[model samples]
Target: MQQDTVLVVGGGPAGLAAAANVNSAGYKAVVVEKEDVLGGAPILSGYAKLVPSGEWAKDAIGRMVKRVEDDANSTVHKGAKVEKLEGEAGNFTATLTNGESVQAGAVVLATGFTHFDSINKPEWGFGTYEDVLTTTQMEQMVASGKIACPSDGRVPERVCILLCVGSRDRQIGREWCSKICCTVSANLAMEIKEISPETDVFIYYMDIRTFGLYEDKFYWKSQEEFKTKFVKARIAEVTASGDGRLLVKGEDTLVKRPIVIPFDIVVHAIGMDPNADNPEISQVFGVGLEKHGFLERAEQYTNTCGTTRKGIYSCGAAYGPETIDDSIAQGAAAGGRAVADLHALVQKAG
Candidate 1:
């Protein structure tokens, strides 16, 4: 069994960053990713631009992937899922679905979150209507450099965006804010307007929860420069017209009246849900889960990366909703901690 190696589950942004740091600290790291690719949702979903910095998502996340791949001490196992996890902190064994096993001194679970399936909300007409799509699907359209209707491939004259599709809704049992949805939605709107300025964009939301200093740069710029209309109301329902257009039914809460708008396409700003693998990973690592189903930290603030089980840590969306920058920072922090712990164990054994 390997003595000083680290097993990093889920080769997303956080996992790749963690592996890079771990390898830099003189420890071998085995990154196990269920998907064939390394960048997780951002890469798999075809995200074009990253928020705030507006850098290409591929370039930003690709650099981290390159760092991991370049490191000789870091090994990436693509298309591999953990089948079984046994042993304790300082010496854990992970068996992959590919019938391979690896032993490590510590474990880092960076399994990222899943997007809220818009299909669950049947009223949104996600799967039913050809023109209705989620933000991820819209990203693909934008990546193609043509924001056109899915039904006929015609340039859409009007586009409607519905925010908070699967988040902050008590009826769906997800009450907490998904954190990044609001900002991402706004960014998507700006992208749409950039590609097609003549296409009028309307964002329907309960509230524009753009946190931090984005008030001037991103959110405000979208409204003022891009002319993206922000509607302060939740969408009641979305119906499809016979001609392939969408009839968005919602209220103008500001004006206290019901408004029905017709658009060529409607985009749902979906939120993040707990990773489907949380339960399996929790059982495998012997870690606890928060009520909301994210990996439980020892403490919310002081111990964001420490799981209930020592030597097994968590970061990124696997821990909670956070930006990519924060996830990278947490990954580095976890890597540093794992190295320190392993060093102490080696010294004690000697």
Candidate 2:
């Protein structure tokens, strides 16, 4: 068993950041990631391509990986998860299925999150219609340098974006904004128009969320400036015509009329929520979880990472909805809190 370390779980933006911060504090850190590789959500987060910055999440996460690998006080475990964690506070042991356990003074949970599967709504015709694709699939297509209609292999003349398929609807269990979908979908719409100027793009949304700095400008630019069609309605279903085209049926609430539009390709910009199995992690640490299964702290203030159980801390998506910047900041904070907890324990022992 490895001794005298902080076991930072999950190796994405938050986990790696926590490890980096803890190591810099003169304490060793061990990062346990379930996947065979690091980078967390951004590992598959193809190309929402960073906003205002014009960089992708993949590029930014790459930089974080280098920092952690180069640090001597940090050890990375790919394809490893703590099947069992024992003891508490100043002395804890995490045993992996590989029959290895590590002794650590502190723990930080940064497990991150997963995306919604848009195909659950068969009416959207995700798998049924070759012209229909989910946001992640669209990201992959964009990254792969191809945007042809999946069925006909021709440059799409009309591309439609369907919003809230897996988000903000009571029919399905996922009923949250997913925080980043609106911006990402809007960003992609503009990018698509830029790439294929001849292609007509339409964005269907219930409400255009334009929070934070200059986000409204982005929404406006995509709608009015870029001439992307903005339809305020809830799409009921997406079907395919006999000729390999797609048909979308929705209610245009603004005009209060039922509308059916045909397009060469349709993209589903689904929303996201907490991971399904996050409750299992919460139970392991004896921490409180929000109704949505995200880790819940003491309040909105002092107990962010601190759990009901001492010596344990949680951050990033393990806690709740937050952006990349917020997650990194919390990771660094969690490291400080944990090191402080350990320093006090050492002082007591001496």
Candidate 3:
């Protein structure tokens, strides 16, 4: 059994950051990542740019991955998933899909949130229409250096982004706002305008939620210099026109009138969904999950990284929608908590 080892699941920013801190504290940390590569969504999704900074997303996340990879006390298992978790607190055993079991003193569930599937909302015509894409797909398009209409392969003349596609909708049973979608959509709008200056980008949103102090700058610039249009409305449906252009139908809430606009492409600013593996991970680790399926924290006010179970902790999107910086902060906090818990466990055994 590996004493003083912390099992960090999900090799994303949070998991990597946690493992790095654990190593810093003179502990061995094993990171089990379900993907072949390290950086999670930001890498897997091929995000061209990161929010707030406009720096290359890959460059920023790559540095974190490099640190974890170089750490002597940290072992990263790529393309591995946690199949089972047994025991508790100080003496936990995690069985991996790759037919390996890791013994650890604590566990940190950083299994991040999955992006909401835009196809689930059929009215948006994500799958049916070639031009209708999710924000993630749009990110990919931007990364690929071409934001052309899929149907015609032409740079779009007009682009419409529909915010809050799968979030804050009572009809879908997901009534919580995905905290990052607004900022991400706004950033993408500016990115699109920067990529193709002639492209007129319109964002149809309920509200422009640039929640933090520094993030509001991007939103302001999008309206000012980028010439992005903001429409206070939710898109009802998207359909293809006779000429192969997409038509977006919605009610302009501000004017209280129904409007249909034709566009070259429509991007669905989708929300985050609970990780599909959350139920299994929660049950295996004996941790609780929130109503929205994010890993539940021990206490909202007092304890930040502690989970319902004593030796188990959670951070990053596993808890909820959080920025990359916040996820890393929680990762460090979780690392500190794991160190304290393990030290106490060792002392008791001694």
Each candidate's lDDT (Cα)? 0.86, 0.80, 0.89
Ranking by lDDT: 3, 1, 2
Clashing pairs in 2: none
Q: Write the per-residue lDDT of candidate 3 for residues 1-350, one digit (tens) a residue.
A: 55679999988888888998999999999999999999988989888788766778899889989998998988989999888898888888989999999999899888998889887899999999999999998999888877799887999999999999889988887788888888888889988988899999999998888888645577777888888899999999999889999999999999999998999999999898888888988887888999988899999777789889888888999998887778888988898889887888788888
Q: Give per-model TM-scores.
A: 0.96, 0.92, 0.97
The pairs that clash in candidate 1 are: none
Scored by lDDT, model 3 comes in at 0.89
Task: Tell me the spans in candidate 1 whose CA falls farther than 4 Å from its real position.
Answer: none
Q: Per-residue CA lDDT of candidate 1, range 1-350, in tens?
A: 46689889988888888898899988999999999999888898888898777888799889889999889998889999888888887888889989999999899889989889998888988998999999999988888899999899888899988999888988888887888777887788899999998898888988888889766677788888888988898997899777768899888999999988899999998888989888988887788999999888887786678899988888888887877777888888888778778889888988
Please write out the lDDT profile of model 2 over residues 82-187, one tens digit for every residue.
Answer: 8888988888988876678888988998888777777678888887877888877787777676678877689999998888877777787765666666777777
Ranking 1 against 3 by lDDT, winner: 3
Worst 10 residues of 1 by lDDT: 213-222
Q: Which wins on lDDT, candidate 2 or candidate 3?
A: 3
Q: State model 1's lDDT.
A: 0.86
